[model samples]
Target: MSKVFAKRLFDGESWLTNQQVTLSGNVIESIMTVEVPSADAQSVDVLAPGFIDVHVNGGGGALFNHTPTLAALQRMVEVHAQYGTVAMMPTLISDDYEIMSQAHQTVCQALTENMGGILGLHYEGPYLNPVRKGVHNESKLRKPTEGKLADLLDVCRLSKLMVTLAPEQVPEDFIEWLTAEGAIVCIGHSAATYDQARQAVESGAKGFTHLFNAMTPLVSREPGVVGAALQTDKPTWCGLIADGHHVHPATMRVAIAAKGCEHMLLVTDAIQSVGSDEKEMAFLGKKVLRSNGRVTTEDGTLAGSDLDMATAVRNTVSLIGRTEAEALQMASLRPAEFLGIDKEFGRIKVGYRGSLVALTDDFFVEATWIDGQKVWG
Candidate 1:
């Protein structure tokens, strides 16, 4: 058994000081609060649930969409681990069928090996709308047919799968089928009206991907995808890039007010430059440069991002004026809930996995532990 104490502990919902957490193997054994701090407890300024990222395309100078290999996946996990990301759904963006098949096999191998930090795989496109495609390759985009959907579903039974598509391009029943098969269907890259987006929600589309960008803007009358996202009464979730470039501070505040932290998530949408010193990388056969804290192609098309999860949590606290506890939830618990894996991964409570992050008072990641093993500092 191991024990850790924190000056302040955010126990999923609220903060408490002078708390000790006991762990056995890879699971938390118990949590206790002490009036006086323990002198020998391994302690830090703040103890938080490890960050969970659902939209990471790449890290450690590697892009999953470019090279779908076990080595690439390990490098990406190691890179993000330094930023307090203990679990992530490595994302593969729009690509050809051959690439997608290769990625599926690679993800299966990684999961079979019980590789640390590889939660699942997020297939972000190929079923997207061309109108709001953003950086996704238009040539590879297509509507989902039964055959294509079956091929994709075949991978989900082996691991958790999240497929982001355009609601306007897919049939309602297909969304239902995907969800029934244990795939989280997310809406993105579309020009769907409010009604179409709402229909998707009713049809089992559980979340919105990279919420304002690449989605139809919410207008006063039209009320596009953004409107549907903000106004949905269901326990629907929306992921924000939160790099301060994809969204403004004021707009992020508005989103928080409307959806609140429970229905919202913070995603990195990170590209290949996260842990590398490289100033540029390739995406979809185009070169993307990182400058001014933004990643964009030569034509100024916003690609993924250069942001990491730890920096994203800091931006959420400072840029949107949210409390540290709330920001940490946005990075960890909320995303875990959205992925329907909170029971196993998100909280620091008894029986939860010992995937935890220790942060400085200033929000810098001092250290990260995954499954009771210290992986990064």
Candidate 2:
């Protein structure tokens, strides 16, 4: 068992001060407020539930599409750990079947080995709409065939799966099939109308890949995918790239105001340049440049991002005018809830995993712990 003492602890819902959290093995055992700190407790300024990112393309000077190996995945995990990401879905962009198969195998291998910070996989797709492909390979974009769907479903048994697809590209019951298979279905890279997007959510699509990017825009007469995202009474969550480049601060404020912070999630959408000081990296045979806190191609096409999870949480407070607790919730609790792993993964409550991060007063990550063991500092 282990004990952690933080000046403040964000226990998934709200902040508690001067508390001691006990952990046994990988799960939290108990938490209690203390007037005098425990003698053996590890102390920190602020402790929070480790960030759970659902839309990570690449990091640590390695792009998953390029390497698709366990070593590459481990490097991504170690690099992102420094930024306080305890768990992530190593996302693969639109690629051929062979590469996708390799990625699936690699994630399975990581899970089999019980690798820390490897939480299944995310395929951001070969089944996306070509019109809004963004940095994805348009040549690889295609509808899901029965064989391909079966192959993907097979991999879901090895680990959790989050598949991002265009509602317009796949068959009528595609989203339902994915949901039934226990994979989280996210709608993205589409040009779907509002009704179509809403229907997909009604059909079991639980989230949007990255809101307000590469998807259809909201028009006064015709409410598009963005409109469906902003609507109420639907349980769909929208993942927002909070790097301040993919979205304007004013626009992010509007989204939080409309949908409320409960439905808004913070995602890095980070690419290879995130961990290293490199200014350039290759993506799908195209050169990507990192500048002014954004990554873009020569023609000014936004590839992914240089943002990290800790930075995204900080931006949520500074740029979006939200509380630190709310910002932390978007990065951790909400994403876990969206993935249906909240009961075990998203809190400092009893029985939850002892995955947590310590941040300084300015929100910089001071250290990180996964399963009660320190991983990065």
Candidate 3:
């Protein structure tokens, strides 16, 4: 049976009305907006593709570092599902070697259960620049060695593994090695020079972890990784945390002024504290206090954010001077393309999965559908 949604549809290119939709099991069977419903109609505010969050460490107060349990994954899933994020990746930051292995294995198993839209996993680090470690455990960060890379890739195995590392930290000889292994290599938490970053970009690095944080700053003389990332030729997509703190509404206007939205991706980089009223939460084996909505550690180092997929979408549109559809693409379409999963998840089409979000005028998620099922509304 297919579910009909009220209002407009993203349609991948533009929003249109007079639509009718049909779902068969876990996929959208048909979408006919101009026709009348045949008896069973499930109308909603506005139907858009389900948001794809690539960097989610924790949710519902369960930190991935604290416990990457199936129950914790469920909590994270439920929290974001309410916010219209039907698909997400469980992210883990720099931690002990055992913890890292456990986290990776846990995500692989979770994907087996296929809770709603758990597409894959994002391992933020084990290899990173200690000087730019942000809130990650600095002591656990290490230079990428041949033996370690082998073991790590084996752990990633058949799961979608997105690794954020400093190109400078990893041996230059291994650039092609990681790329050849089908790893979604993202440059982040690095202080690499422009040339170093450019070389990695050419080697098949597709994106950045979180733009403008814990990474090299763009300079006139050096140009840094930011400049290389925003480079037009063989450029890398920048994952931006648009929580208004991690990045200001105005900076995005300037940052993407020339590069455009296609060069940028919206990542919440959300931590365990999301969906909570408590002022602070635990991070990096310490209690990170949040005052004035800024999440930071006791040492004053900035930590992961508290925003969800829905908040990021709304903020990108309402605050960042982008249309709702435009912001929504950054959350879903653009990210899917960045991960090379666009054909299946980003757009609303005949063969694509029927994961979608229905939002009100204010951009808040009103209803969410995962694989043709009404999971939240």
Top model number, lDDT? 2
Point to the candidate with the largest TM-score.
2
Better of 1 and 3 by lDDT: 1
Count clashing pairs, candidate 3.
7
lDDT of 1 by residue, 79-156 (tens): 999999999999999988888888888888888888889888898988899999999889999877677557756557
**Candidate 3 residues 234-260, lDDT tens each?**
756888898889877787877778568
* TM, every model: 0.96, 0.97, 0.95
Candidate 2 at residue 106, lDDT?
89
Q: Residue-wise lDDT of candidate 2 within 66-97, one digit each (tens)?
A: 99999998899889989999999999999989
What are the per-model numbers of colliding residue pairs?
Answer: 0, 0, 7
Model 3: colliding residue pairs: 2-23, 6-44, 18-33, 18-34, 19-33, 20-32, 20-33
lDDT of 1 at 343: 95
> Model 2: clashing residue pairs?
none
TM-score, structure 2 vs. true: 0.97
How many backbone clashes are present in model 2?
0
lDDT of 1 at 332: 93
